[model samples]
Target: MSYLIYFAIIILIPIYAQMKVRSAYKKYSEVPSSTGMTGAQVARQILDEKGLYNVTVEETPGVLSDHYDPRSKTVRLSSNNFHGHSLAGTAVAAHEVGHAIQDQEAYAFLRLRHTLVPVASIGSNFSWILIMIGIFAGMANLLLLGIIFMAAAVVFQIVTLPVEFNASSRAMDQVVSLGIIRNDEERETKKVLDAAALTYVAAAAVAVLELVRLVLMYTGMTRSDD
Candidate 1:
């Protein structure tokens, strides 16, 4: 059952995101945003309105390649969104901008997660080395260390859930508050953003399940370990 749930998420979450991705673009392809503003314009407005001028909005190449870079102070929207003026573009653009707000406020969860990123990266990489040493050396203690290190990757994923969800909430609220998207179109804006949020939720769940499975195998707790 556990493995099934994990596999289901692995397969289904991307499918859902792609479906919504297609639907969002299809729905907004004909009717542009009420303001007739491009995504770059909308992103700029949100940054300005929030008194966050330090952040720069840049047009990036590729489809569905939008993201906010806190370190670089840049908000990058994919070409489709950077130039397109549609419900899909607006929602995606606003979502990236939402991360900007989180940066401005120094949101506790975001700050904590950001601080842990370096540590998590180091732990995740070295964890497998420890697992290998443990297995090859036949040392129970070394094997245990490896599992613990590898598990840090899962914890990092777990911690990321709140950061992503909070950003989405901020994005949705800003979308409505800015009135950049029309009231009539708000539902679709929310729909697209909400669907995007689920992908993150699915990711966190998969990480957690992976951790459990790893724990079982590491301790000889499963039949697979022989």
Candidate 2:
């Protein structure tokens, strides 16, 4: 019952954050920007201003699928955001460009986060298998090893917050400085970015809670064996 309650609470956070972002996107997407710049155009201008000529902007299929590809030096935006001349679209586009800026500037946290990706991936993929094997064999050390692996995943999620928040902050600054949005429009764009940032926060929260649950379950299992 306790686990269920905790799960119910933690699960709702991401769901709510998703809904909030969607709602904000829908609302602002209808309101056209005064600058009339499509998302791709904004991305291009930001890259040019920052002298990121090597970076390329491309339109990708899917809703809210925008992301920065560090390996390819590319910023991919979803169809709607790529073509839409709305504050929401521009805000999201600038945010992705912010990641590119981070990559270009060698932002310390972003670099650290990138370095942990492989470790986190390995941990996520094999941690469960190791834990189950340990449980069946009653090996506490193996279970603890699994916990450490999952902990790496949790650390990755935690590191992700700074990268995301800094990106949004950069996006807002660029948007305002470039006159892409002004006054009331600036407020609306901030709203969009804020809602989007919540999604990352919720993701980290869920990951931490999941790690705690895993530890608790293993503790109970070890106690039963003893």
Candidate 3:
């Protein structure tokens, strides 16, 4: 039952978070901000203020695909968020810009996460193959190696939590300080970022749960072998 519960949580939480974010974004996307700043404008102003003039803001093709590319010194905003003057658009754009600020400020966790990206990508990609081979061959050492790789991915996800939360915090602070949002708009803008943050929390939770499940499965296999 515990296993089933964990499985359900790993599966359901992300789905719920995604739905919540989409709903919130859709609701706020239609309501234009009183400041009349498009998301691109908000991001540009915030970047310039932060002395990140070298960081370019560009429109990316996709819904909710916005991100900051540290390698390129670019903030990529989704189509609607790039041009829309809505609270949701500005909020998301500001959030991505927050990442650029973090990169510039050398935010500890963000820097660490950036360093771990390639390693975690490799670990997550190959760990499943190692796990399957070990299980089929009754090799505990091989399975343990796979578990270690999965653990690396889990650590990456854990580090990501602080990086994401801090970015959202920075986004909220800058948006208010810059006068991009005010009064009721402040609260609504927060709702948009908070909804998006939940998705990151859900992703971390899923990774942790998966790591635990893998450990338990490996333990079961070893005990059966004994």
Query: TM-scores of the models, in the given order?
Result: 0.84, 0.94, 0.95
lDDT of 3: 0.92
Clashes of 3: 0
lDDT of 3 at 138: 84
Model 1: clashing residue pairs?
none
Top TM-score hit = 3
Q: How high is the lDDT of residue 154 in model 1? A: 73
Ranking by TM-score: 3, 2, 1
lDDT of 1: 0.80
What residue runs in model 2 are displaced by over 4 Å at the alpha carbon? 135-137, 220-226
Best by lDDT: 2
List model 1 lDDT by residue over 1-226, tens digit each. 9678777867786677668756766676556888888889889999999998999999998877799999999999998789888888888888899889999999888898888888789878898888777767666677777777767777787787888888778877887888887678988787777777766776677666656765766667334445
Model 1, runs deviating above 4 Å: 1-31, 132-139, 221-226
Q: Write the per-residue lDDT of candidate 3 for residues 1-226, one digit (tens) a residue.
A: 9778877878899999999999999999999999999999999999998999999999999999999999999999999999999999989999999999999999999989988998899889999899889888988889889989888888999998899889999999999998989988989998998899898889889888788877988899889978
Q: RMSD, model 3, all Cα superposed?
A: 1.4
For each candidate in the order shown, give its overall lDDT on alpha carbons.
0.80, 0.93, 0.92
